[model samples]
Target: MVYTMLDKATLLPDLLRRLDKLPQGHALDLRTYKRNRSVLIRRIGADAFDVTEDGFQKERFQVPFSGLKKLLKVLFKREFPRSTKIRLYALGAADGDDLPTGRKVI
Candidate 1:
């Protein structure tokens, strides 16, 4: 398979546009990997998200949600590769006290 480097400058705008359409409580689960390591990003809000190592919930932590342009720039520079395939999921609103199953958005 061929791997292409993702252009953060161009990708950020489209990503932000999509995120804006989601409901307030929706979440996006981003999964990326390279060789033997993987990273997970659970974007829970338009301006906020949580990061974890290899999908381990126990290792998750909240990350400040800046604008999409800035966030993507940072992610591209520091974390994901151009070929990283991010699987986005839209989580439904939880009931009074329960976690919701995420539905695939794309």
Candidate 2:
């Protein structure tokens, strides 16, 4: 598999778009550069997801599709502030299995 490196400017939107296209029964794990703070997003419904944060609070909550973007922005700012690198992994996923996934790095 090939991985595309994302600079600070494009990482946010790219990650948001990728996460939006995630298929059902799939989960995406995102970790900071040092693997210090992480977030787990599990799709549970067409407009719902279980978001788990392994940061200071270690909290988990359900966020709707409408709020995903905002939530991501907040999480990124809070957990990934000043981070120069980020790692993302999609669990139980295959390359080229989905249209968006096929075109984007995963």
lDDT tens digits by residue: candidate 2, 1-100: 2233456567778877776887865677777666667777778777788787777557778988788888878887888789777777667453323312
Judging by TM-score against the true structure, name the best candidate: 2
Error of 1 at 21 (Å): 1.7
Candidate achieving the largest lDDT: 2
Task: Give each model's whole-structure lDDT.
Answer: 0.45, 0.68
- Model 1 lDDT-worst window of ten: 96-105
Badly placed stretches (over 4 Å) of model 1 are 1-10, 33-66, 82-84, 94-106
**How many clashing pairs in candidate 1?**
2
Clash pairs detected, candidate 1:
6-82, 47-65
Q: What TM-score against the true fold does each predicted structure earn?
A: 0.46, 0.74
- Evaluate residue 23 in candidate 1 and report its C-alpha lDDT on the 0 to 100 scale: 59
